[model samples]
Target chain A: MVSGALLFQSLILGLLLGGLYALLAAGLTLYFGIMRVVMLAHAAFIILSAYLAWWFSSVTGLDPMISLVGSVPLFYGIGYLLHRYLLSRLRPTTMTMMSVLLTFGIALAIEGLLGLVWTGTQRRINLPYGPTSISFLGAQIPVVQIISFGLAALSLGVLYLIMKRTQFGRSLRATIQHGQAAQLVGIDTTKVAGMGFGLGLATAAIGGAALSLQATIYPSLHWHWIGPLMAIIVVGGLGSIPGAAIAALALGTIRVLLEIPMGPTWAQTIFYVALFLTLMLRPQGFFGGRLAQRF
Target chain B: MPNDSEVRTAVAPPGSTAVARLRSLGSGRTGPLVGIVVVIAVLATWPLLAANPYMLSAGVIVLNFAVFATAWNLMGGLTGYVSLGHIAFFGLGSYGTGLAVIHLGINSFVAVLLAAIVVGLISLLVGWAALRVRGASFVIVTIAIVLVLLLVFQSWRSVTGGSSGLVVPRPFPDMLRPEHHRVFFYIFLGLLALVLVSYLVVDRSRLGQALKAIREDEDKAQSLGIPTALLKLAAFGISCFLTAIAGGVYALWFGDLDPIFQFDVVLSSQIALMALLGGVRYLFGPLVGAIIVGSALEYFLLNFGETQFHLVATGLLLVAVVLFAPDGVLALGAALIRRLGPSATSIREMSAADVRAQQDERAAARGAGAGGSVTEEPSERASDD
Candidate 1:
């Protein structure tokens, strides 16, 4: 029912879309690895950052991409302080469950605050070149998506360096593997935890800015974004960053590709169905490997 | 009952046992039941006292939510499977009733019953599937279920009426009259009564104890020969059954069934929040939560027009409850009473406080402590701080 070029174009767009998804899901997976908390408010946090990015860019007459210059550091501190003062207190046995409820409450509060301030009006970062398209292998690609994809790759690359090379990253990996065991070796797991959460939120900030470029965002728009991100992480395996990256891109492509024939609603439904099915049949995820037990 | 008595016996002085027993008995299982009965009596006759249409209308909403929360408590409180997607069954139940009413031309009341069965069977399947994964996975799976159902309901426009909404025919033909309000109020109130009695029985029975055991330690419960999985599924099914009935009744009364409006995450969270606010384990916790949430929601909708101040207010309250009073209001109330007033001087007061304080202190200790049971998982990075 469709042309060959359209299918090729969709595949390209899907990978780009998935690039954004990885950036978004990375924060959530990082939190799970460190704290075993699902961070239900992750989507709300992203939307909140998107709003802040929008406001900052509009006020300073800078591109929304530049808003990340402020948003990432700001949310890092917010995420750190939040983990210390509030989330850290929940008992570990129940932390997994309580965090979902508590973060859900936090999500509601964020949505409410955003609704009050933004009035549910959808806003997007309107770059002058946003509407322009380029012929990439004979398929039209929007400039906004391309920029967002490049920025996403840069951010993900930085994330890789931090996770693999830094002292903080080593401690975070240790804590993820074993909290008390890491502590026994003279590591301050609590400090590592706070910083890990901060790092996660920082990624969310970057992801949010990129998201606002290609998609219209509002207070409740988090609801739509959350399901897809959850599907990505769950499909990739809870704590496996590489797995999440692959799953995000694969699922993102499939969703966009499916949209061509099935329409938007069914395409989205298919993603959520995958989330449900994967979670039900294989709680560890398709490729999560030994990293499955972290969450 | 034996556990309660044995614990009280240990805490109180041997000579003061009789007095402690009397005081504690008045406030234990029977005490709450009596209080609930009197509250029901007052509510049952409330329309006669003041036939204000507005109050009756609002009361119906409270009762509807009370049923929803209370039903949710059956699953969450008993099994510790706090579902974030009970909204799926709720929406399904509403659609079931609406469809049954529309197509079969059956009595709306009968349709409600039929919807309950449909939802019950569906939940059995859902619970069977979702119960495979516990904890975070269960929560996410539930969310997925609700979201997927929402997509189906939204896209399958031919049957569901889609975004425009399925217009349900109200069982009562009156328009905004006091009589119309009273009918729903009584119907829900009646359902609440039946639900509470069944819940009270379950709460006091071996089954309830087994469910609580599952909540506290599923591995231990299973080791002890309790069919933890089956019980969880049953509780889930029962919980969804009641929630669906409430949804059906809500549809029949309100005359609309929109996908977004019915299968809402907010409503699901609100109901879960209500159960949390009320004290999930306590028999009347959800009832208490429903009254607070329902009334507060109405107040917000009325005063702050065209906005979401209510959402903000409830969200803050939910956070506070999770942070400070994870046990719920009744537990909080008992603690306060033990701490501040009714001085520990009187023997009766001493016994009551002693009995309650013992339980409260344990709960408090658990609430205050960090992770318990040396569950040193393989990768647990051994950290002191």
Candidate 2:
């Protein structure tokens, strides 16, 4: 039942996809880390970005990579404006529950808008070199997969640099660790929160581009993505970046590997299974409490 | 994402005491009773009165969602576990009844009841495992419940009929096609009435009080000798059971079980919002929310033809409710009624000083919200009958 080479291929593909998943989840964790808001709109935004990418490349005749230059900042600004105008106004005591409600609403609106605009028909990007594959340890790896993986890595690296080295990163982390204490120390937690939300949304642009390259896209595809992404966050631990990243890669690999035996339909369940098992045994998440103490 | 050290923002919520006082300038007890009577009369007469089929069917859909929102409130409003996946039971009911009817050749009515009981029993097991984790974990666990079932129902093609879905045989074959809406409307309205009466019973019972205490602060209730876990599980079971019955009835009436629509998280969220929009703390919160939201949805579909504006409308309403009326529209209505209507009832209008005192009390509650002694927070539900 277990073929070695196929398993290796599954592993490689799973890891590549996982890298992008990590990027997608990074924004969710960032928002949660700073504001304790489980932004359900994150998934819908990714779907929105994917459509943006599709429209951009189709109209401009440029690579989707080029589309990201415009989309990333555009999404970031939207997130920034959203936080400044709307989310910032919610009371701290009820922010978590309220944000979940608000974001779900936003997500629905976005989904409906996308459906109206895109007509709910499925579409995928056509990279000239998308179908070509390269030999990796005698297992064929798609060129797009390699490039997307590279993109995800570069984005993640920049994210890590911003989180670890920048003054903003310090403030963000401080707020995540203790918001009141951060404010007491004169950190503009509000501004940081807005920017953090923007940064989180900014990733959606890249994630959308990455997702469009790999999968079939539709207006309601966000629902499919949200479940696995949620599983990743839960297994990774709330508000923990490294934890989410690690969980994404592991679960993503398992999900792809499961495809061989379980078929794509059944394998899609791997995320929920991982989530259920994790919730039963380790509700705080694998990297939540013990591994490298959450920020 | 449980953050205990959240900074209390300086911004006052839009529906603060100031708004309540302004609203109290119009709020009352008899007003809602009168409103309920008007609603019942309107609903009862609508089917009998000369009307087109479209309006009649809309009424049925509204009642369907009304039942869902009310069932969802049994746990979400009362026990404060906002489950986004409660619709999983609804979906299971669809499949369970469909499969039972088609495979076992059982009577449709019997299948409906059987499916509900089976789903309720399943919920107890699921709730036992899920209730172990609270807050965000519980949310994810519930989502996982739906996701896993989606996979099972989707991949298990032999049993569930998969994406192709099962066609449930519609009951009352003797009735004509146009008569379906009229019959189901009465069925759902009667169902709604039963659910409302049950809600009132729970609201007045010891269990309801304990549940409200749990909502206020679960750990405090647990230490005060309330069986927190068991009660949550029980509430979750009942919530699932009722939701399943609604779904089963829907299956029997509609005769389709598409996993996508049945297990929809968006629909579940919408149900959750309906409850929240009405005032989850109040006994009639779900019914009020259901009527408002359900009618609004129907209006959206009617006005914005050939577009998905209804989804956008639902989204906007959810946002507006969370932002401006977090305590719900009924609470605001009650506030207004207290202001304008004569105080024939025992309800007293809250003064500015009383509002200030209440704000301080809520602030103290927030302090207890994060870290507290394992103790009880008394349930003082905002009044409604």
Candidate 3:
């Protein structure tokens, strides 16, 4: 007999976890939507941002949110250059092979560099609201969890607005839909691709900022996130933002629920097993059709 | 009915038709078969020439990777699936052998066979589910499958020991080190030979042609009644079976099984690098690539010393190779070698008119490549038509 309060607590935790998942999945979906290149290195970039946040918080007492002010812009520049200068040159056949190798190389480089600088120790940021709690209904919810979910929703809302109302967003969508047609209409595809990449990386920065709250981060955290992140993207349907959010929530809920009965180890396998089954049944994906429209 | 292999063989070289080339390459052809037999004979006797333990150990490593890489090449290079989760098969094999020896008290030979079969069955299941998706989806699914397997190995502590890892004691504790190593080395070499012969047979056979057709155009192959699904599953099973056997050999050589060591991403990435750096389309691509990259990196680390720069150099080398030589170093080096000594090169240069005719022939092949009716283009989810 699970109490209403206990169920409420799980829901709150799932919501918070979903926010973090959405933040990671959004970037991945955006990259896939625009370029059709699965940025396998996206997880590494998130880990990199987390390490940077940890460094800033430790060194200057700057908050994780404040650290993103610098990291997001820096990552934006890096992503743009990486897409334009490095990745854009390859043809599809070569691109498919090179992206994996290149991303693995990038992941290794990030890990090697982080090792040189920070060593293998896991780092965490201490927030003032780290232990604070808020009363909701009959149960107490953590302040960090509330803030995490709120921030994730607020940022996603802004992203939705930008994609819906902005001219750049329209052009970005156009480029994704048909590059040749978009070019014929005088849209600068290269710029659109670069901006799309930048937007993806920026989301990673935001995610990194949010994720450093609950989890201890090391360079190897990249590996841990990659599996779940891919699952989220698949379930949400590749390139669909709303699909990603819904999928993240669904997955997070399943994971949290499974954790209670099956143990964490089995729960981890359950998510992947579910994802594998989902792909087998619906190869085009759950949200792929809606996503095709945005593209 | 002749398939593109025949066309590729026939038109690929002048003074030789596809049938003639196939025959020459030892698939019933006279000339290439004899030459290939001679090469095999020479290679088989090479161990006797290099009797040093150090050399023998190095040879063992080479043979081990050569077998693993060849296994990888089928799914990754030849079939164009590019699996990143191949170490799952390897890990399964290690665990199978280790479990058999410890729990079931099985003989080593029997254990190897069981491991291979287990891995093959697992691969068949994964392929049946995963091959439904195209392109990057297949890659992602394979990786996820491996990740799930890794989690199982880590979490199933009673059976797998979680992070602490499982150890399998050597079956023969009394054997001398060099003698034991030599026997294992010979075993691996024999495995390598069997794998190569199998690869050659498949590569020259009708199924090989069908697999390539599917890779080139799945829809077209499906329309032509090639059974793309079954072919992919078959390829996956075969590839995984060989990889698992190699892993079993690794377990026997090391006398232990560790999840972290056996099923690591590094193993997966290394196989991929080996397959690509050699030449995916070539039969010996992985071996060539592994020997070049592996020996070079080892030399650099050992002789010139080690630093973070070694990793940085490796990363840079990968970038450089992808950017400058998408076709692999073998192709690029052959071109350079030809330019340097065109007169003495094994490949004969065609006359200008012949070259023009060859270009025309290639354009026709390209037309066939592009002209074949299949929705090679990804379906636009929004487009109604």
Candidate 4:
């Protein structure tokens, strides 16, 4: 019999971690949805944003949260340019393979650049409320985690709105649903694809800011996150944001809960195992069934 | 049949049989075999020519990677599986050899053989599980295997020595001095030659044709009654066997085993990158890639040990190669020669064009067949029209 308090704490912690994972997967799924390119550099971009946040906070004596205001748009423009100039030129038949290689190369370059600039030393955002905890339903929760969770929720909400309410959203959805039809219907798919990629990167900036608040980060920390992120997006169902978000939560919970019985090191294996099993058993994913035959 | 002959004529061109035969003599089966022999002969006598320990040691390391990359190409290059978890087998072999020599008190050669068989079985299992998925999913599964193995090895401290790693007894301790680098260099060269020979034999066999067919279209190949899954597993097993041998040799030479270095994703990525950089489809691609990448890495590390400039350079090289020269350095070189040299038209280009045309025709025929099937149900409408 597990103690009520331990279960409660695990639940809260899991949800919080999951919330952040959802934000990360949101960007990845969006990219996959629009471009049919698995952006392996997603975690690298997140780490890059974290570094940016760290630098901004250090230089201006401001909270890392403020870095998102500038970083998101900047990342958006970068993503747009990357798609327009480099990614768009690839043949559709070879896009998956080539994109993986291209993104992996980009990830390597970014990691190397980060190492050159800041060295391999781990860095975390030192917040005033870092050590402080809030008493929530008799459980002590870190203030930074609560804030990170809140930020993740807010960004996800905004993403949902952007993906549903706006005209651009409709066009993006149409293009994702049926590229040829959308093209025939006068949707400039190329433009939508570029913007969609930009939106994905903008979310990465937000996720990065949240990640900075949650944990210690280094240049190569992306390696640790890549497997889990891939797992979350894949489990959530490649292009489905809500599905990804839900899967992220479940996986995050499962991961944290596994730590109770299996120890921390083994807890890290849960996502990878989950990813492998999911790919084997249900390659279309939970929300990806409709889109499976098309891909 | 007439169309087939016309296509062949178009691909080969007239009045070029003599030149084609000469080119074949230089590049065909006999050519590469002779080339390999000549290179080996030169390398074998290198110690007599100049017994440079440093150069010989570097050469050994380069050849070791060449063997690994060639093993990887057996599956990745030929079958298009692109497994990123090959380091798992390498690590397993390292540990297997290390454990056998240390605990079982076996000779290094026996340990190597034992490790190869073990890794081959493991590859069969892994290939069965992972190869069910296609494209990116397959890649992800392969990476996951490496990550899982890395964690398992790291945590199983009692057996694997965990993160601190295990130290193995070196084979031939009396001859372990730097002066004996020549012997190890020859050993690595022989291993590389063996790997290349295996690749050649496989590439020439019916099994190779089946593997290539699976690479082209699994569904079509399956429809034609090809045993794709079994062939893939076999290919993966062979690939793993060669890689494990290399790993065993590395274990005996290096005398230490660590999960981080042995099962490193970086090392796996480097192997894949080198294969692609040299040209994966070509038999000699990995060897060329290993020589270039391994030498460049050694030079950079020697000069800039403190910095990760080499990784950046590698990344740039990868991006450039993937984008501009997906067919690889060999193809790029051939293209350049054809464009700039006396030959206005090359056999490679002609054949490439012919292949593309054939593919287009097949696709058109398939489309028409589908149309015919759909129209078959409209017999009454056709009569009314």
Candidate 1 residue-wise lDDT, A1-295, digit = tens: 7899999999999999999999899998999888878888899999998899889878887888887878889999999998998899887788888888988888889999999988888887778888899998799999989988998899899989988999988988999899999999989999999999999999888888888888888898888988888888888888889989999999999999999999988999867777767766787898786656434
Q: What TM-score against the true fold does each predicted structure earn?
A: 0.89, 0.86, 0.86, 0.88
Give the 10-residue window scoring lowest on summed lDDT in candidate 3 chain B: B375-384
Residue B352's lDDT in candidate 3: 42
Local distance difference test, candidate 1: 0.85
Q: Show where candidate 3 strays beyond 4 Å.
A: A1-3, A290-295, B1-59, B296-315, B343-385
User: Where's the lowest-lDDT run of ten residues in candidate 2 chain B?
Assistant: B1-10
lDDT of each: 0.85, 0.82, 0.76, 0.84
**Model 4 TM-score, all chains together:** 0.88
- Which stretches of model 1 miss by more than 4 angstroms? A289-295, B1-33, B49-51, B174-176, B340-385
Candidate 3 residue lDDT tens string, A138-211: 76778877776776777788788878899998998899888989999999999998998999888888787778
Q: Write the per-residue lDDT of candidate 4 for residues A1-295, one digit (tens) a residue.
A: 7788988899899999999999999898888888778788899999999999999999999999999989999999999998998888777766777777788888888999999999999998888988999898899899998999999999989888987899999999999888999999999999999999999999899989889987899998888888888878777777788888999999999888888888888999999888767766787777774653223
Model 2: per-residue Cα lDDT over A180-274, one tens digit each = 99999999988998999999999988889887877789887888888888889888988789999999999888889888887898888889878
Fraction of true interface contacts that also occur in model 3? 0.40
- Tens digits of per-residue lDDT for model 4 on B1-385? 2332332344344687877856755556455565666766776775676556776777778888899999999999988777778888988998999999889998888999998899899888878777766766677677778888888999999999998989988788888567567777778888877888778778867888999998878889899999988999899999999999999989888887889899888778888888988998888899899989999988988889968687788777877877888878998888898788855757667866786666656655775877654433344343365
Q: Could you list the CA RMSD of all candidates, in the order they appear?
A: 10.5, 12.3, 10.4, 10.9
Q: After superposition, which runs of candidate 2 have C-alpha atoms over 4 Å from their true positions?
A: A290-295, B1-42, B342-385
